[model samples]
Target: MKVTLERTDLLKSLTHVHRVVERRNTIPILSNVLLRCDGGQLALKATDLDLEISEQIPAHVEQPGATTVPAHMIYDIVRKLPEGAQVSLETSGDNATLELRAGRSRFALQMLPEADFPDITAGEFSHAFTLTGRDLRLIIDSTQFAISTEETRYYLNGIYMHTVTTDAGERFRGVATDGHRLARAEVPAPAGASGMPGIIVPRKTVGEMQKLLEDPDAEAQVEISEAKIRITTGNVVLTSKLIDGTFPDYGRVIPQNNDKTMLVDRDDFKAAVDRVSTISSERGRAVKLAISEGRMVLTVINPDSGSATEELAVDYESDPLEIGFNSRYLLEITGQLRGDTASFSFADAGAPTLIQDQGAEDTLYVLMPMRV
Candidate 1:
């Protein structure tokens, strides 16, 4: 393949596709990116068997052809080159090496047969919909933190996506949980997603897809089938195999009758919990939350270390209650709240506590209390 492309443009495209390439590979072709020059564009593709990413960038084609070259090495070489430098890439014969040139620098990179690269076949998707980049990013950032890293519960290692209709109407929802905490968020459902089947998007795929949605103004096209899911935006496409196992029914973990309600400044509460937890090296970083008529106190105790307590004025009228929770879980849930105030509802110290963003009911967080 012989093509001439600007260094800045090439690096930008490589930045997107190179991340999908595995750093270490048992198969030789897996470490290389498939480059195809056709129709005034250079298409770069990379995959790690389970996930594949492809990007097309504008280029001047001298001799149209295709070849495979090391993904990371080429990325680094182009990245270090002077800005706006013109890059020329050409491959000699069938088994010949790949030649790269820019100004006074030139290098010959080993090439691999393009036929050895694994290809992911696009499946027949039963449902396809579009979402704004801002909305998609909200769903991922709000719930991805709660996805479990536990290998045994493979289903919980991804965000669960499906369509649900409230008493009002149908809405698109995303749910994620580890054993200790759960997060759920909803947005307006797309026109054709009414009967879409629920799917667990694996953790790695969620990350890669999220990266592509960084442009808040861009829109993403999502396609889902029984076995896999695909997301496309601009010149980029990402496809991944869905986790086959079933996700736990998360509704049961959310408490409905929690009567005690406490409203506190979100930042203040986060700061208090963060400070108090520092004293308790043991007890699994537990911090006790004591709520009374109009005051809330955070306390942490460790015999070998020390104890800490901080008080803050809150909006609570329920009976006094004291509950223990892991500090890390509390911070994660509260961090997702974009507003200034945070509300918590509790039944007792042993029951799960429900958290919400003051007046917003569309998003909810549930935390399992710990025994102190």
Candidate 2:
């Protein structure tokens, strides 16, 4: 293949596709990116067997052909090229290597036969839908952090995605839980999503989707089946094998009647928790929250480190309650809240606590309390 493309265009596409190539690959071809130039467009693809990403960028194609080269190596070479310089890639008549040229720099990389690249996007999809990048991001960002890392309970490792009918209307929802905490967020369901089978998007795919769908206004096409998912954003297409497992009935874990409500300035509460948790031990990272009529005191006591405390005024009229939670989890949840006010609903210190942005009912978080 002989193609010349702007450094910026090639570098951007490489950044997205190369990330799918893992550094350590049991199969040599898996570490290389497949490059195909034809019809005035240059396409780049990379995969780690389980996940694959492909992107196309405009290029001046003197010849139309395809070859595979190290994904990271080509990405780095193009990334370091002088800004606005043209990058040319060509394979010799023998097709054993690919030559990359950018201004005064040049490198020859070994090429693998394009026939060796695997194709995983073949099967039929049960459903297909479209969502704006904004909605797509909101679904993952709100819950991704809570995805469980425990490999044994494999079902909890990815964002659980499905459609639900609420009293108000049908909504598309994403839920993730690591046993200790759970996050659920939803957007109004789009066309072609009703009755679609719930799918557990693997952790890596969810993260890649988040990164690929960076433009708020861009539209993303989603196609899914019980075994895989494909997301197309702009010129980029990402496909991944789904985790074949059943997600637990998370609804049972969501608190139903936590009536005691507390309103606190989100910034104030976050700042207080950050200050008090400074002295918290790494192993036990627990921060105690003592909530009373209109005051909340945050405290952390570590045997190895000194205790720290911070107080903030809140809007709670219920009886006093003290609860402990992982300080890191608290900060992460608070940072995701979009409103100035964070509403907390408590049912004593032993039960799961529900938190949400005061006026935004589309998202909610549940945190299990720890004994202080």
lDDT of each: 0.91, 0.94
- What is the total number of backbone clashes in candidate 1? 0
Model 2 per-residue lDDT tens digits across residues 1-372: 789989999999999999999999999999999999999999989998889999999999999999999999988888888898989998888748899998899899999999999988899999999999999999999999999999999999999999999996999999999999999999999999999999999999999999998899999999989899999999999999999999999999899999899999999899888888889988999999999999988989999978998888999998999999999999999989999999999998999999999988899999999999
Per-residue alpha-carbon lDDT of candidate 1 for residues 197-218, written as tens digits (9 for 90 to 100) = 8999999999998889989999
What is the Cα-based TM-score of model 2?
0.99
What's model 1's lDDT at 294? 93
Candidate 2's C-alpha runs over 4 A off are none
What lDDT is reached at residue 45 by model 2?
92
Off by over 4 Å in 1: none
Candidate that would win on TM-score: 2
TM per candidate comes to: 0.98, 0.99
